[model samples]
Target chain A: MVNKSISEINNRIKDGSVNVVTAEEMVGIVAELGAQGAAREVDVVTTGTFGAMCSSGVFLNFGHAEPPIKMQKVWLNDVEAYTGVAAVDAYIGATQVSETLGMEYGGAHVIEDLIRGNTIDVHAISPGTDCYPRKILDTTLDINDLNQAIMLNPRNAYQKYNAATNSTSQKLYTYMGSLMPNYGNVTYSGAGVLSPLSNDPEYRTIGTGTRIFLGGTQGYIVGQGTQHSSKSGFGTLMLQGDLKEMDAEFVRASTFTGYGVSLYVGMGIPIPILDEKVALATAVSDADIITQVMDYGIPTRDRPVVRGVTYEELRSGSIEIKGREVTTSSLSSFKRSRQIAGILKDWISHGEFFLSQPAERLPSDTVSKPMKQTRGTAMVRDIMAKDVMTIHKNASVFDAAKMIMDVSFNHLPVVTENNILVGIITAWDISKAVAQNTFDLVENIMTRKVITATDTEQVTIAARRLEQHGVSAMPVVDEQHHVIGIITSDDISMLFARRN
Target chain B: MKIRIIINRDIVTKPILAEAIIETGIPLNIAQAHFDSTTGEIIADIEDTEYRMIKNALVSRGAEVLRLDTPINWDEEECVECGGCISVCPTKVFSMDEEWNLKVDTTKCIQCGTCIEMCPHDALSLDV
Candidate 1:
């Protein structure tokens, strides 16, 4: 049963004599008890993760005909490779498949398939949709003199939807240019070339006239434009722009594929670890319960030993039983001897020998002994204190202080009308609230959450709760939200001291 | 004279009694018993030659004999056919039966709870 009063359990626990058994110990105890005529009622307690993972692994291993898409191998081709559009489409398609399958979503795979494809007209293709085409020159152009230029003109840059896929397409242009110049081995001429007028319409003046020619200008300019074209053409006519369209499709598909693969492998593994932790926690709890039951005593039947001689044998002065010789000559007082003989007679009559003392007892003063100490089987109601103080959600600060002073408690439980524990109003909390004047109502000043303990819990558990919450006191309550007792730090200290 | 008493089992009041005897300063006779050994039986029967000294030593040590003489019998037929009691018994008084039921190798059963709890037929009982 859940201990409602945290303080009381904590007190017993602090005394250092509470029985806290782990799972392995419980198993031994259960076996021992079963041997001693008691039925084992071992119940396994755990969080859900262990079972979940076992189920998941089983399902993954056996449920599917083929390996799940997450583990499936996908391949990408050249057009999909160049613009990376194919990867993106594959990613989106995989997401759709995952949603349709009702299985946990895993990502897609993107493999860069480098295949040979011909370069097409740049003006007809879409940006980021068509693969970037290369212009392979048969001969290297003069590095100093070549001026390369590219121009693109598209009918539209923004088209929301097309009948082909009902997906929007955004067009954009990018321009890149570079220049290289070479100037070397120059000679200046001044005589005939600079002559004043010999059949030349223009003649150079005589004073230091010189002519010079400069060479070598090399650069390239790149530009692009996109037009929004809805595929209204049918059959053969549609084949006209298939190359550019396919290039665009590959770019989108490639992007989706890469994204899908990443989501499946990288993000899915950690999600299941949380479930594993839950299972571990449950196993530990079961072990603890088993240990507790085993430590309790097991019952056994009686075995009686007898040592006696009949009256006739005594009179004859000779007796023997089980190959042991009997000597009865030391009887100084006949009556006393008869009394001793009579006691032996009784043991023999019952067909059992009774040993007057216990054969073995555990050492009373050892650490292990204390650890195995059992708290009597008393329910929480047996130890719970009924006098409890509670505060409402909207109570005022003054009202809270008055309640605290009246009850002489360091902390007060604050519950809603429905009896749920919404918060706690400790003296420290109240003092802070009052000092700041930041909140007018108790709800504003009160701690919105508080750790609680049940009535049926052991004092050891209560002490642990206290330590875990780092609180000096906690309120004990029943199922119906009624406060039963208040356990304090001092109570735990006294309980621990007394137990020692 | 100083004397030491070695008990075969963990006795609760032995140390207190020992201290009391030491303060009295009486001639002591020491008897030692191996409690933690395989056979946890007390071998307190000192030889007649050393009886006087042993008696004096026990008195000096404040060793009170709680039980001096008691007749113990083992019922062979009533013995349950289980061997668990043998394991926990300090004195090796009981042994297992090779042929029939749980036979008491009276030489081995120290009468510990091990066998008593182990017997499923409710057979083994202690004559205390």
Candidate 2:
């Protein structure tokens, strides 16, 4: 076995003889050759993961449109893309839900479309200026037309991620994947010790400016990831790079049905065997990385802690949560992770890629508040029911009654043709009318004047309205006078459930 | 261009691929393949002109040519473009344009169909 230096590895990389193995494969080498022998023989260990990373996005300069508008408003396929930058530049966030499709589509889909080299419909309405006269430019877009497409993510590759489950009776649609009610299922995001940042707990060789395989392209670590808690069970890092180098497949957009848009970031890291210590770091397996399984149904940053459990427990297909052994599945792919590790290993061995020394070490001094709760940013919009079951003006009285009994809901907002909140009927009102045998047209029994709330209103406003009206639920309207959602008492109760 | 074909359970014992080559003059390049008594899904490439000939030959040999609406099922309605499929895509069929819209190239696709596993949207799937 030879103790190959970085220079020697680079030299071998040039000559196409660099000895590389995936972190999965390296475990076997150490078992056969021993840690010291394997450390001397191997130059690099590649690690990877493909999972839903919400903190991912792209910055694109669309160049100048014909008679360019200083586009204030931007939408890619009806999903809002941020136009806060210069006129031609837009930052397409991965989580921005489509105006048309709502949470079903978003900016992550926009990024995927761009990478696929498909034409994107770029529609922008601007408050026109003399310098930039166009008020609206409806145009088709091709990725090549952009001046710059930067993949600048504030966070990715969580060192250790939580396995989320539900304790409450209601199912939670979250970025944590779908948390079934009554602990029916758990969705764990961590690749366990196979997780990139978790393997390098101290961030020795993997750090800022480190070349990494990101979304099928070479990307670098830019800075500290948000909520980067080194004090927590694992170390996290933030990264950025050019989107141009990536394929459309690696950086994908996904909508978790009701949960909204999220990006599946494909990432790979090369751990150079600097010494036996470094080799040992790569040896850390699923059994070593202890992570938490939080109750997503608990609804707060400081969600109800189920218990600390190892990734081995996580991967066992079920976890013991609050004395109940609940089943668990992965949002992150095990197959893709192994595939990425293999790809990196081949790239190093065939001299197609070379590892570079990170320009800076990952900062250890960074403060990550364990209580960094995002409760302050919680808006009425986030909690509002986007899809409310409404009784159509023409629907029969039995149907309305059944809707209430089926869901045990108190209020039913009656909607007109354009989804206008025409009137509201309560289960209490229905019982009174039915006792009187006045079960004819709903308008005859339903309240003609309905107190309503708009989707843009604050939680305080909705809460105030509910108190003032002494109502269990209020219809939430949008600008088009559409009944977009209903603010129910049960929905408001969720705020308090997570407050502790 | 590449297309996928399913094998009948009865034909699981038959060398259908070999028969396809013998019966049809066209050459088939199997990029990705999976076979079992329950199912035989193969993604194979052939010249455009040979599509009908290959279909007829395979059909005669107890094979079902899976006619896809588009073998690459990309639903723009649900796609979030998070790039889960990019890393595992063997053909690089999926990518993002300048506008960040996920675009698909059926031409480059060998129809490996790995995107179905990684899509959080449940938006992508091959007809096969």
Candidate 3:
């Protein structure tokens, strides 16, 4: 049974009667303390949402066996009777538990309330779960006993977290199904892990596990065609060059089209770059053009011309000119004029017909150029520093500050024995802790929440992640939560220079 | 020499008529009226030969040709008080009889078969 109220919890913290714990061992320690009436509220902070889910599962399953009260809303004195079970199973069964316990499962809101109410006597935070844990714990706990727990199964940590927090039911089931390795092995799969669905094209797999069948087609225009004409009355002109040349031309054309379309369509619609041009006319001898016009009894413009029109307007018959109907024949003629103008422009610029131009030779016989490399590439391994300095949850803030200065490092990766990244402690955190005069414990000064990257990721991705999150540095970790290296803005700057 | 080829054949076969509504404005039922198989000439009630190119393109891609006919025009006065044209038109070209006996919203009409089939008064007939 819980004995202390919100005010009494604060009083215990003020008098130094209660000590904050951040380790798995603190689970039993705080439970015992709570039972002994050391303080009514025992705040449990985990590393992240995943850590919170896993720890909450363990606390609810194991701590509830002793009937430990899990604090919900500290201000409202709302408490839920917990049951001890594995974090994964507990998270999966959270909805059922909420329904059975008649409690509102408001995700991280419940955790937030517990911290604000100062009911949390101990916080067991997992490193990569929530966005902020250090701030929450520092405000509530004694900050000295904040120990990190390295869990054996981090995938289970993620699965349990996602299952409890994600809103989509189908996504939850898909995640659970993915966890099944074989029979009942219960292997956990990470998020965004891809797997083959089915071989049959008739029933195609769409989004992850979702599948849809191929349907039959119907229409008058079954296939599309390119419309081109020759002004020389020959009907055939070199419309497209060799594949490579055509591809290069297409790239340039696409760039122009993208810019033009973006200007016309605005930034919202992503317009695809088109390679093929709508040829309105082919190059014709001046004599043939005059003869053809006379033979066809058609009116001729002063300048010899051919036309081209976009395929979209042709199919839809939706193009209009100043509130007047543009017939296909008229459009074809107009396109011819534009094509002629384009060809004339190209000819005038190059001093030759664009179609008849010879390809330029490559400088393959020339000596290979020497490349200038940056510091990051010159000393890739040295730039990747290892054995990063860290501080324990229970270490004194003064000691943590001394260690930071001693190691000549600004940031430290907080982790447990099993090598799970728990949190990050920075010089700034220590400074804040010193300013607040809470330097007595590491938990009080050390940042309990941290942004981290995986070791397998590229430094560019790491840099982008840092930029996106507005962080100066990040701890690189392995799947087992072991800190491998620390990435900083300096390293990223070198990487950017090398790339450019 | 400009050779005028008359194709008296169905532009779209029955099997693929449903898709014709979305891909081409010509309805599956109406596509049959535009072609003349005997003369081998298509007197298509299309606005012009652009539709002919579209039909030829479709046929070249394995769509079977059947018959062709001129498109139908609706008599505004004789059109029944029923609003079947409004509901049946795929493009929603027709509306309720307000100022006139029957109003045709020509802009929205895509020449699908629904409005022609649903009209009970037989007031609507081929324009060409």
Candidates 1 onward: DockQ, in order = 0.01, 0.07, 0.01
Residues A1-500 of candidate 2: C-alpha lDDT, one tens digit per residue: 34556677788889876788888777778878778988888888899987888888889888786786898998889988788888888888899988888876788888888888888888899999989998998888778878888988888888878777788776556676556678877767756656888767778787777888888988888867887777664556687877877875567777775567888888989888888777878887888888887877654457877788887887665677667767666677666677778788888888888788887788765657655555575566778787678888777677788999987768888988888878988888889878988776666678877777776666776786688678778888877778888888778888868776
Candidates in order have lDDT scores of 0.30, 0.77, 0.31
> Candidate 3: which stretches are off by over 4 Å?
A1-382, A497-500, B1-128
Docking class of 3: incorrect
**For candidate 1, lDDT tens digit of each residue in A328-435?**
111111222122223322332232321111122212222211134466633344444557778888888888999999988878888788666778898898788868
The Cα error of candidate 1 at residue A489, in Å, is 1.8
Who is ahead in TM-score, 1 or 2?
A: 2
Query: Fraction of native contacts in model 3?
Result: 0.00
Query: What proportion of the true contacts does each candidate reproduce?
Result: 0.00, 0.11, 0.00
lDDT of 3 at B104: 67
Model 3's number of clashes is 68
TM-score per candidate for chain A alone: 0.26, 0.76, 0.28
Off by over 4 Å in 2: A1-4, A322-324, A370-500, B1-119, B123-128
Per-residue lDDT of model 2, residues B1-128, tens digit only: 66678887888888978988987867898888887658888888888788899998898888888644366778865554544455346666765454324568876766666556546868787765
**Decreasing TM-score order of the candidates:** 2, 3, 1
Q: State every prediction's TM-score relative to the real structure.
A: 0.22, 0.64, 0.24
> Lowest summed lDDT over 10 consecutive residues: which window, candidate 3 chain A?
A261-270
